[model samples]
Target chain A: MLKVRLIPVMTFNGVSLVKTKQFTNARTVGNPIQVARVYNSRNVDELVFVDIKATEQGRKINLPLVKKVIDECFMPVTIGGGIRTFEDINDLLGIGADKVLIKSKALQNPEFIVKAVEYFGSQCISIAVDVIVKDREYLIHQKNDEKVLMKTFIEKMHQCNVGEFVVNSVVCDGMMNGFDKILYQNVSQITTKPIVAVGGAGVPSHFTELVQTNYNGALAASSIYHFTQYTPQEVKKNIE
Target chain B: MIVVIDYGMGNLASVQKVIKSLKKEVKITCDKKEIQKASLIVLPGVGSFEQGMKNLNDLGLVDLLYQEVIQNKKPFLGICLGMQLIMEKGSEPNECNGLGWIKGRVVPIVNSRLPVPHLGWNNTYKHKEENQGDTLLNNFYFIHSFHVLPEEAVECTYVDYEFRMVASIEKENIFATQFHPEKSQNAGLLLLKNYIESYA
Candidate 1:
């Protein structure tokens, strides 16, 4: 049987590793290289690094920093944020990134996703969908403060033939409470493709809740890893 | 020296980095001379079967690989698409010919409730207990939509993903795995170390 993946998401502010609450109030946590080494030693299933401000800054993620981080990782690493073109993807993959996550560019131009999938294969391309809950309904949250219906956005990207969807809950990000189960359930209903639930994982029970929903993977940022005593292996044991 | 054949497929750095960490002299190149000098050849790739074959052909590596791996019997290791390419044929995107080193056909993983591209970590079991030292029965990272079905019985490791699928194959000097041992953390590193030491 395929084991459910436990992925640790490391969000960067271009220079340093940081944590965000509801996608705002960026707080510096630790050095990314050191953090990646820790994850490598812990033997986490996979690692994700995202440059949260790269797209808005109109530049690509810090390549040198990512290269150093990847050096410390033996596990598969996914690189994202400010990924706008074929060159960006090529550079990251060349530096040993196993997969590249596309968010803003995927929405701004769905054709880019199609072309990327066609050229790079779906296994290497993952689409990140950030969602915010409004009136008990999931809405797609854009960097520019504009919110679109989550269903419409998901349906549009579904046609692009990307490998998997990294569905993140902005409202539950860095909350240390629990994951948005309904949000994941809704997205799973929309598409049968693999869904990796991100944001709002705080405890072992939270992951157990996620597993009950039959999702493929769980991506946590501030779960027991940063804010508590439980190790990633411990959390994975609970899920099993 | 281990030459990681880089046919412009996908990331070869991870494979190179792992070999370097294992303290083995490794090079990533498409040069015929480098491959000929290599004590072992590692072919690592990620993409469609059609594109993979095209790149190998375009780079003019198909003939060199055949001479080095098949004719000369150089120790060879293939990962992911590298493993798939050893089959007689594949049907990813469309029907295509593979290297035909192994009697098999690569086809989409179907008839399962699980999602396609059987992604993430899964435990592998040895097809026969006697062939234990070569293949480890541990969890390894896997990410692919198509798997190779050997036409004849081969000494292989299998993983259960609602069905038994070939995880790795050990045929004489040729060793190939559908899982990314480089991306599988400690278990992966150990597997690579074992492979190199066995060949060494």
Candidate 2:
């Protein structure tokens, strides 16, 4: 098995890097270069720079912003948010983004996921799934931001041959309360690939506890970047 | 001095920047004289197989690159489309023939489910390699839609997404990477450093 990675989430607002809660209440945290430098120095596994507003704005992956992050980061980086075209993915990879994340688009056009894998090779493909409880079922977020059944999408995505999945519970994210293990366990039971849990990660032990059972890694925004009680290394140490 | 073959297709500045990071002397030149005299030459391209070759021909460097990299055996490296150019032919175009230095062809990354233009840091599954990390294409950064599917992979880096294309190739004095080692963080930087210390 490949090494389980610990990816710290760096969500962007326009060109500036900011910290937000459940996709709201944006707060200026620091520069992307400075934050990336911290992640680099701390010996984190890799970093993910997500543009929370890109989808809402109907754009592709922010190339210049990705370049800015790559210019400073020493570790591997995975980026998402508004990546909608092959050209965008190509340009992003060309410029320097190590990996590109797709959630809504994969749901919209599963063939894009397949073509993405074929063109770049499957190793570069990353599938992201945002899950939430709707009428007592785990539903997925469609491209139009609508809700659909999760199991069907997960099954299809696995068929798409995505290397990894970043599964975050929409209701649980940014709350720093905890992770929705139900969502993780559900996906883990279905797919053999690595799964990284995102959303509501508040403490160092949270990551450790999650990886113990099934999930490969736990991603946190508030605990690592905000509370400052533990470094990514320390958090990883606690988890391992 | 190492010459970064100026084909005007790829991220030249980044490649140049990476070479500089290794504290090595580099020149971005299409001049065959300058390139031929250099100790090493780099061929980098970002566009499709056809346009890339067209650009090289239009710039009058296709033959120049062939003479230097293929014939001279003066340590040559290709990145992405540049790497594909070493193969005999690609799906690029009819007139868009590669240097034919290596025996192979560029095939689309084939799969029914995955998307086109694979983009990301896919872990390399080395295809039985003599070198784990070298001048280029180790466990490095990769971003592309098409790759050089060599007849026999000389060296490969393994990754999880799929059996990745040959990460790096070493034949005689020629070396190339389907993935961009320059953009591959420390692993990539180390490759450049190796090029400076050992090959060049």
Candidate 3:
């Protein structure tokens, strides 16, 4: 059986990128190239580059920025930032984006999902779910930063043919309050596709303990780098 | 040199950069002679199957592609829509007919828990003989919605799902990855390079 691996997501908004959260504000961390090199040395399985600025700027995947990412990183790189069209998707994927994440695009024009899969293949596409806890239930968050009921989004994606999903807990996002296993558990029971749980990073055991089912994997940021709590290498060893 | 078949609407440059990352010789070309001359050929595209098929027909490269892969037996690869094109026909509303190199139908990953145009990177199992992980499977990227049900299911190596559909197929001199090896980093580039170097 192929075991679930770790995918460290690095966020970049506007021109500057950040590794850690400074209250509600995100702070600049280091150069993407340098951080990627650190992960590379650790034999990290995959690195995700999400340009937070793209959707708002009405831009596409930053190929030149991607070129900068290509400079120092040598692992399987997944670029997801303001991707809204087949042409944009093609450009990024063509340039060496191992995987492209579709969030708002899928919600807006579900056909865009079909268009992507028809052209790229399902595995090449990933659906990212920004999660939030409300009224004792997990929910789906969108690019407009709105949280919708989970059932609707899941249904929408299922109808369209999404390959995998990343359930990111907005509540647990930066607090390191431990992963919301409940959220993953809820989603996994319903979906057969691979689920990557993002949002919180309380600790390593939190990952092993919180994620009850064998199918889902937890994704964290601050806990791994700035907090100096766990490195991707260490997490990989523990998971194995 | 690996020749990237330019259908004018496919993912060409990305594949080119990926090949370059592995320090391999590659070119994106629409010229038939250049395609014929290359030791390896790649058909990479991103669009509806109907549009892709139409592009091939309009460009008049379909016959040449079939001739190159079938008669000449050069190692040929099709990614995403490229892979679906290998099938007999795509059942989507697109009214597309694939190259028919393999006996199969390209259909929606029906009742897909995931959305259509199944996009993103998922793991792949290898074909029975190819399960040992060749230049292709080390690490690969994937994006697609429709999957081929090869008449020769036994020819399929790895399987993933919008619903238990094939993700990759290997039959003799012809090999195709349903995922994007180029976008898959070292694994993607390595697979492309390995395919290029592996003529036997």
By lDDT, the best candidate is: 1
Per-model lDDT? 0.86, 0.71, 0.70
Encode model 2's per-residue lDDT on B75-105: one tens digit a residue. 8888887888888888853545677888888
Candidate 1 lDDT score at position A36: 93
Predicted structure with the largest DockQ when compared to the true one? 1
Interface RMSD (Å) of candidate 2: 6.4
Q: Please estimate how well model 2 matches the true structure, expressed as its whole-model Cα lDDT.
A: 0.71
TM-score of each: 0.96, 0.68, 0.74
| Model 1 misplaced stretches (Cα beyond 4 Å) | B128-137
Q: What's the candidate order when arranged by decreasing lDDT? A: 1, 2, 3
Against the native chain B, each candidate's TM-score is 0.93, 0.86, 0.85
Better of 1 and 2 by TM-score: 1
The deviation in Å at residue B183 for candidate 2 is 4.9
- Runs off by more than 4 Å, candidate 3: A20-23, A37-46, A53-63, A70-78, A81-128, A133-165, A188-194, A214-222, A225-229, B8-10, B46-49, B87-96, B103-172, B183-190, B198-200
Model 2 chain B scores worst on lDDT over the 10 consecutive residues at B129-138
DockQ of each candidate's interface versus the true one?
0.89, 0.12, 0.19
lDDT of 3 by residue, A1-240 (tens): 234557788887757667443224677877777777777666555677888768878876568877677555555566787888788877776666656887888877888898777667666688878766667766675545566778678777866766677677777776776776677778876766667777677567666665455544435455455466678767756665
